[model samples]
Target: MSSPQFSFATTAEEVATAFSNEIKGKNVLITGTSLNGIGSETARVIAKHANLVVVTGYNEARLKATEDALKKENSSANIRRLVLDLSSLAAVRKAAAEVNSYSEPIHVLIHNAAAAIGPLNLTVDNLDSQLATAHIGPFLFTKLISPKLLAAGTSGYVPRVVWVSSGAHAFATGIDFDALRKPNKEGYQAMVAYAQAKSANVLMGIEISKRSKGRVNGYSLHPGVIYTNMNQKPESIAEMQAIGILDADGKPSTEKFEWKSIPQGAATTVAAAFDPSLNATPGAYLDDSTLANDKVGAHCLDAANAKKLWEVTEEIVGEEWVF
Candidate 1:
């Protein structure tokens, strides 16, 4: 079948409705989910047709709220709540163990939460806050959950891992494994740190495909700039102002970017996970709900860097991913 044409104006519900067959009977999981972000909206759409939808976050109340909201939207929707804080390796390990206990394959996994536009703060793992939340934590979680993803793939479902990246990835041109090992607080710049983390997110799409040999497809996307909770922080706004994204009044400047609504922001992510057309290009990146590899930085697409990231990540996480 020819790929359905979608654009920036499309909504997650539209794509979910269009690809309801792909979603039917599928069990999907999304991280960083809450009512205030794209993850919940992505989960909402998937829950409309998916057999089971697992929503995760660090906050138990927020996960419960997300569960209530999804159920309100579709009473028959099957929703499971998991507490996952991507910035914490300890939390990642605990969550990974919980997911394994269920013993069900996750047909689609979306790494949608991120810690962007923040001051440098190191986690217990000694990784920078932005890098740990946006990349390393998700990287480790994906590795730990590979058994579930592989089970789905072996069962004839084309399992996928989707990383929601950002256009701000252009702020960095390369990976800094040393910085991840030893965060340079004195020289730390939020944009650069966040950019490198997002860049790692893009590379996951590239590397996971090669590692899994197409059995578990990987995809990355830019969920168009939106005013989510990530943007509501004063520090986040200050960082955006430094880059001319927001005005002195903290409003999105129309000249520099066209911000998307929450639903529109999640459209590309939904398409990345459920669009059958994406199966043809396992590790491709998407923008505005369309395949747009040219939109990402060349550094993020480097095959050598992708491989290096996979290796360094295992060491940083202190675990081996044999698959």
Candidate 2:
């Protein structure tokens, strides 16, 4: 399981082409696949080789758009559009049920959806919106669809969960248990919440690797700094301009931060999903396109926090994951 020679500049199509054997005929489910996003690009390339590609989003119309886009990339693609709002448990259950009904093993499940860094808002389940959408909902969805992943493993296919985290996870040194339980207006900062949620995604990878007991592999990664809908907020654009990420005319620049194109941004995710080199490390955190050895923050390396988050999420979702 030697690491492949891939860099931040690699494109998703390149990785998919390189791993065409691995991606061929596999069933992949990806979340947050709206147009002009990394998830959509990842799905589009995989659809070129996959037998079934399920594109998911919170909006039905957007999911349809993603489905059409994938089909355009591969005319023979078998695409399924699923509406999944990660903020709601009910929605997660419904989506999981739809997936389970397919009777096909899910060879790869990519949690590419996330809530934006924003003001404090609680879901109907009384949890922080960011935490619920980014971690808790994906946690529950993974658990619910795990049987399909395990089924893939039983059939001699390597089933893995790819978590699309960020290097920004360095913002928080650890998970905020209190904030997850009770998100209030007091002392709430958007970046901190975003950090915790992103770190939790990495933690989920760690715990899934430990708990899955070799039946499933888990991976998390930073997809470089690709400007997508996730970071195109009005205030964020003004701030980016101040930091030289955007020029005076509000166009992207290479002055301060080096950015990636959507396909380049998706390279790590595409590699994590199909690259056999990553099989060596079950709970791997990658940056650029390979292991994030020095780049990943200390907070993301804590196995204890990963375990605790797994347990707490079970309580939040009111369903135990024993596999």
Candidate 3:
């Protein structure tokens, strides 16, 4: 099947046009935004439409700058910043706790911050950095803030959590159950690790949605590859170049692929967060801004795996979840 291309060229204003005054009072939080990435643009767009926009990243200065920029666009916009390092469980937990302090309910939580690397690395907790940042940290963060989301709106409908996953997840043959803890000397297959992390993200979303049972929505989306930093990390770029995946100028090697502009890359995330029509399908995989029935590998879609991961994550974080 031929894959369709989507552009992220849409500006923040263009994407925000889809939303209406109904979204005006909604509280929205976006993770992984920095000055130059898609997250910054996501923050820009959310700040325009949502009542409150909580922007988060590891860089304090950049976070403040993005917050300021958003404020300039919408002075009435309630914009805040949280410096979070998703690779660290301690930081993630702290960030979650801080997010819970807000009295207002969060209408939408976008898990858009994730990592792609060409080398195997470990976090402070000795877990795979990619996996922790992409799956575990975001998972815990969502669980922590779910109550706030539930409190924001009616009991029947709470906030939605959208996991910004990647189509690369289709490449994970199966999850490495023990590999997450044990160091594999296989010399860092960036593609495999990225795929595994993304698959886990999808599974995590499904599990969270199942637990919510339509009270809230959860989505795993592959927002067609935009030429964003997340997809072109330094190590991965070197690895791709060595393998002929990229050309001399570092462009994707003549592969039939969709490269979205920043706004377009963020389209599905914004839609999932604010689109009321999607309320019915609380747990679904989204691709190219559409509901996807693309059958993931058995393990990627396995309820058993999701539960195991959840249980193990709780053990790692050493806390009881309120959500």
Candidate 4:
């Protein structure tokens, strides 16, 4: 089968309008919008088409700013902001509860928030900060939201969730079940952990799609490298630069590689979230808006491993998954 060619020269608003039309009356709860980052831009784009836009982030001020911006553009659309810190399970549960309290069914969820912890660092959960923010936190959040999504799907909402994964996910070996902490012995190892988390995201998304059959469509997409704030922090941006990950231009050198302008970076995600053709093709890894069948992203293709990761994540969260 031919893979989908995911490039788009269109503007972000055009992509947003196209995607929003797919779920015009559906509720969309987008996380990580409180920060001045890609998530905010993504939310703004979605707000243009979605009936209700729920924005969330850890910073109250940034969240408010995002909310105000969305409302300014679409005064009549229902928009709300909730401060959420995905690093803590408590916060994840609370946010999930709040989202579930809504009477409307949620149609889409985009997991775009991630932290790149370069130096060896641990969260309060004794997990690597990158792993916590990128993998564990989002994993738990998905678990918490599964019931609502399942309900929505059963209610004829055709609920869907999109995990904003990355091509760097190809670099990881797989999840380490024994060492859930993934302690980094070297600086380079930290980058490996980040890849592991990203790979896990793709796997988890695939698993959700497989498990749901055609009921709830879940997908993981690699938005081509766009310059984003997740790379701004020292531990992240500096480390990548130190390792020659960036070109002399000081930006992520996607010239020799592949990079997307913001709109192009958002293309695959929009396609996965809205394309009518993909409504039946569940559990597929999408790179640039097409199914990835090559060894290019093999780590995310392990169905058994994905099931294990799902089971372990559920055990850690101490809750039963709804879907």
TM-score of each prediction: 0.97, 0.94, 0.89, 0.89
The better-scoring model by lDDT among 1 and 4 is 1
Local accuracy of candidate 2 as per-residue lDDT tens digits, 17-54: 98999999899999999998999999999988898988
lDDT of 3 by residue, 1-323 (tens): 22123234544445466665546778888898876677878778777667788899988988888888877877888888888899898898899889888777888888888776678888888888888888778877877777887777685456788888878788887677676655475766877888888888788778877877666778888776667676477767876677565767788775655466777777777666665656777777776555674655667777788887777777766765535
Task: Give the Cα lDDT of each candidate.
Answer: 0.89, 0.86, 0.75, 0.72
Name the top TM-score candidate.
Answer: 1
Report the number of the highest-lDDT candidate: 1
| Residue range with the least summed lDDT across 10 consecutive positions in model 1 | 149-158
lDDT of 4 at 41: 71
State which candidate, 3 or 4, has the greater lDDT: 3
Worst 10 residues of 4 by lDDT: 1-10
lDDT of 4 by residue, 18-42 (tens): 5555767767777776444667777
Off by over 4 Å in 3: 1-15, 242-245, 252-254, 320-322
Q: Which of 1 and 2 is ahead in TM-score?
A: 1
Distance (Å) between predicted and true CA of 238, model 1? 0.6
Which pairs of residues collide in model 1? none
